[model samples]
Structures are given as C-alpha cells and as structure tokens.
Target: MVSPMITEKVISNAPYAASAVTVIAGFTVKDWGVIIGVVLTFITVIVNWVYKHRQDQRESALFNQKINHHQKHKNN
Candidate 1:
C-alpha cells in the first residue's frame, strides 16, 4: 500500500491556501486591514495579560516571605 507523504513545502503552503480562499471570497484591502488589526490587538491583549499574571504571582510570593520573616522575628 502506498501512503501519502506530507512535506515541509506542503505545510508552508497552508497560508497560501487560506489566501486563495480569501481571494476567491472577494476579500478587499479594507477587509484584510480589519482582520490584521483584530489579530494584532488580540495578540497584544494576551501578552499583557500573561505578563500581569506573572507579576502578580511574584508580588504575592514576596509578600508571603515578608510576613513569614516578620512573624519569626516577632516571637524571638
């Protein structure tokens, strides 16, 4: 039996496939601009959210350490 071969060229052409479909569907320059804007905005929001979450985690850890240290010294 002969199996299908999936190569790098085929994988890289995936974007072209989407472009072909969009072209066939008559997407204009303005449509592409809106799509690009929305994608960039979504990516930016996700990056900021991830950064803020990590910062909060770090601050919480530092606060816990300070409380623990103060308690230890208060008892001495």
Candidate 2:
C-alpha cells in the first residue's frame, strides 16, 4: 500500500543521491605535506611514551631506596 506522492518524491531524489556519490568518488588527495605531518605526529607520540617510561622507572627506584633507609633506621 504505497502512496504515489511518496513514491514520486523518492524517485526524484534518487538521481541526486547518485550524483553525490559520483562527486565524492571523484575526489582525490593531493598533498605530500599532509602525509609527512601524519608520520611525524606518530613519531613524537612514540618518543614521549619512551621518555615517560624511563621517568617512571627512576621514581620507582627512588621510592624503594627511601623505604629501605627507613627500615634500617627503625631497626637501629
């Protein structure tokens, strides 16, 4: 039980949808700088991760030394 008015409206918009798809499909990427920018962005993230890991290791070692010193003082 389809209405003729609704069917006409849908049929009219079908060509526009196809045209929009064609336009989008024809688009192209034309930039070398953008590709290089993405690569450097990932490199910066990796370097930051390594630096943070080393900082955490140093902090953990310092905390352990402090705890050992406290235990030695308490026993004496």
Candidate 3:
C-alpha cells in the first residue's frame, strides 16, 4: 500500500526501513519466559501503536465528515 506521507522530497520507503530496523533491533525469538514476556510486551506495543493509529485516522475522518455535513446545511 502507498503510504500517506510519500512526497517529491522523500520516498518514505517505510517497509524496507521497518524490516531493516526490526532486524537490526533484534526483535526475534527468545529462549526463556522472561525473554518471551519482554518480546510479547514489545509486540503489544506495536499492536497498540497500529490500533491507535487506525483509530485516530477513523476519528479524524469522522470529525471532518461531520463538520462538512454541518457546514453544508448551516450555510443555507
């Protein structure tokens, strides 16, 4: 999917950057429960990040639509 931030100045090559960062950051399999718990928490963070991002997007879209609709009738 095309990112919402790509422009003429910067490519915003995010998938490649994300994979590279994930690999370099060493977010991989672990041997112990404590280690796994840490990884799970990290995973939780990523999940929450994506969820909040999408939620914010939805909320903004709804708010914009509401304002547009309200203005359409209020201008009459």
Among the numbered candidates, top TM-score falls to 1
Clashing pairs in 3: none
**Candidate 2 on 1-76: residue-level lDDT in tens?**
9999999999999999999988867656744467678899999999999999999999999999999999999999
lDDT of 1 at 75: 98
TM-score of each: 0.68, 0.57, 0.58
State the local distance difference test value for candidate 3.
0.82
**Model 3 lDDT at residue 41:** 100
Model 3: per-residue lDDT, tens digit, 1-76? Answer: 7655666325557677788887757744543567878899999999999999999999999999999999999999
lDDT score of model 2? 0.91
The Cα local distance difference test for each model comes to 0.91, 0.91, 0.82
Q: Quickly count the clashes in candidate 2.
A: 0
* Winner by TM-score between candidate 3 and candidate 1: 1
The alpha-carbon lDDT assigned to residue 68 of candidate 3 equals: 99
Q: What's the candidate order when arranged by decreasing lDDT?
A: 2, 1, 3
RMSD of 2: 7.0
Q: How close is candidate 2 to the true structure, as a TM-score?
A: 0.57
